[model samples]
Target: MFALCDVNSFYTSVETVFRPDLWGKPVVVVSNNDGCIISRSAEAKALGIPMGAPLFKFSDFLRQHGVQVFSSNYALYADMSLRVMTILEEMAPKTEVYSIDEAWLFLQGMEKLVGWQEWGHEIRNRVQRETHLTLGVGIAPTMTLAKLANYAAKRWRKTDGVVVLTDPERQRKLMALANVSDVWGVGSRISKRLNAMGMKTVLDLANADTHLIRKKFSVVLERTVRELRGEPCLALEETPSARQQIVCSRSYGVKVTAKDEVRQSLCAFAERAAAKLREEGQFCRCVTVFFRTSGYDTGGEYCSRQGSMTCQVPTHDTRDIIKMALSVFEKIWLSGPRYAKAGIILGDFYHRGVAQPGLFDEIQPRANSEALMQVMDSLNQSRRGALWFAGQGIEKPWQMKREMLSPAYTTRFSDLPKVR
Candidate 1:
């Protein structure tokens, strides 16, 4: 059997974990720079505040409804996610971390020993009690169906956040009630196509001819159909696959026009990307720098530029990556245009100890690079944003605005929750 566990209103729930006073209040978490609503609590959703609604447009509405807003605190969310995933790892023998707020667990042969529904309930309750976060659990014979069950668990209140679908009749009834779009892999386009073909419900697509679906859509859709019919086509990934590329980018807090400001932003991004590469135990041979004006900026000439450079050697050293990134940034930057965002991309990856050396060129090995990186990472991990490169600049004028950010309750000792 398979089980899918998803946190309910992950960001808002994390916020409430440390601020019990905010419980049962209308809470919404916005994206970077207070761009838009990304996560809303049940109370906030009841107020008809749609997801992704720009914060500026809803200021009056938010004030009238007494809705609390917060900027995205990724540090707190990431640490909380690690704690939740650790609990799942302890409970299940095999698990796949699907996303920050979701995971899939394989419960092979456990059906015969215990009641599956009760086990699902226990998982949900334990997670809630231990993490102070609510979760929905869906269990079924296949991963796809397990996802569907999870949807039902979250959608309905009577289930108490746990739903187990083991019988064929119950699965078909649930599928019949669910729209085609609610299925695991069906997007808006696929839903429209399926609706046009008279497959409006999950059961309709599950009963449709697999060959026709394959011919009309794709092999992937056909596999979804089989999985909905109680066939297991997707398997849990025990380990996450290596990333092909690592990108670090962010919108600036304000419009920047100076070359020095742009250079500092690029340097910071390159440092972050290089750190990610080293964390994954990989080296990159290519670094790309990109910057662009705000899409909303209508005044003057709008500009966007990107440039790539191949490294002299595959290296994960932050200094080497940042040097190349800044050099490329100089080539692509436009002086007249006001830049609103900048990013760095690290690609052409090779696993450590697997990079081939250039035949005719001499490459000096940095004997202390590994040790230096270890110390850097250790300090940064111990205290968030504790280490920095001199080139990144001390006064970061381009940093994103996070005015409504809450204290880092879990990661920082000074920000820990206190009782009077």
Candidate 2:
């Protein structure tokens, strides 16, 4: 059997973890730049405040209802995620982190040795006791079914945040209750098509003929059908592959028209991408810089501009990447347009290392470059202070707005809550 463990309303839940006053209170978290409501607490959901509602449209409504709002605190969220994953890795025989808030645990035949519901509740209780964050636990024979069981666990309050689907009869009952769109891989468009064909629920899709599903849809959907009927089609990846490219971009909080400000933003993005590349233990061979005026109302001749430059050798040094980013920015930076967003991409990663440099390659990596980068990374990761390239600018007027961001309570020492 496999078990899927997911945090309940992760973003808003994280907010409540460190703030005792927020317990049982209606809370919501906004997306980048505090644009829209992305996460809401159980109380907020009960009040019928829709997810993804524009904050400006519902600001008055939320305030009138005593709902708390906060900006996206990515630093705190990421640190909390790491803590939760660490706990799972220590408890489960084998764990696959499915997302920031979901993890898969493989129990194989161990379910027979322990009572299913007892074991599920054990995992749930441990996570809640340690992290002060509630979890929904679902146990089933297949990964897809386990995900469905998790869905049922979260909705049915009597489960007490845990659901086990070992019996075929119980699985079908829960599947029948779930809409087709609620299935693991099925989306809105696919669900609509299935609805038109009289398959409006998960049980309908499970009863589908494997051969017919394969021919009508795809091998992937066929596999999903078999998995729904107690066959494992997807297995856990012990090591997920690194991304082919790292792109860092953000919409400016305020309009930017000056070349100097755009240059600072590009440098900041390049540095962040380089730091990620190093964290992945890989090197990048190309750097791309891009900037654009608001596509909605930019009256400029060109709405966007981008250009790329390659390196003589793959490198993860931030200075090297920043230099290349500046060069590309110069080529694409247009004057007199109100820039609304800027970003940089670092691509062409190498693991086993790239081909040898040419005999006459004029530029070479700096001496002791790797050691120098380690120091910078160490200081930055601590979060107390960071050493940035002077080009990133001390006063970043073009940064994304996070006016309601909470402090990094778990990640930064200065933000730690006082006992009193």
Question: Would you list the C-alpha lDDT of every candidate in the order shown?
Answer: 0.91, 0.89
Collision pairs in model 1: none
Deviation in Å, model 2, residue 335 alpha carbon: 3.6
lDDT of 2 by residue, 307-394 (tens): 9998778889899999899988887778888988889988999873566767776446679998999999999887533788888898
TM-score versus the correct structure, for each prediction: 0.95, 0.92
Q: What is the C-alpha RMSD of each candidate to the true structure, in Å?
A: 1.8, 2.4
Per-residue lDDT, model 1, residue 291, is 95
Cα lDDT tens digits, model 1, 227-283, are 999999999977788899999999999999999999998999998898889889899
Worst 10 residues of 2 by lDDT: 294-303
lDDT, model 2:
0.89
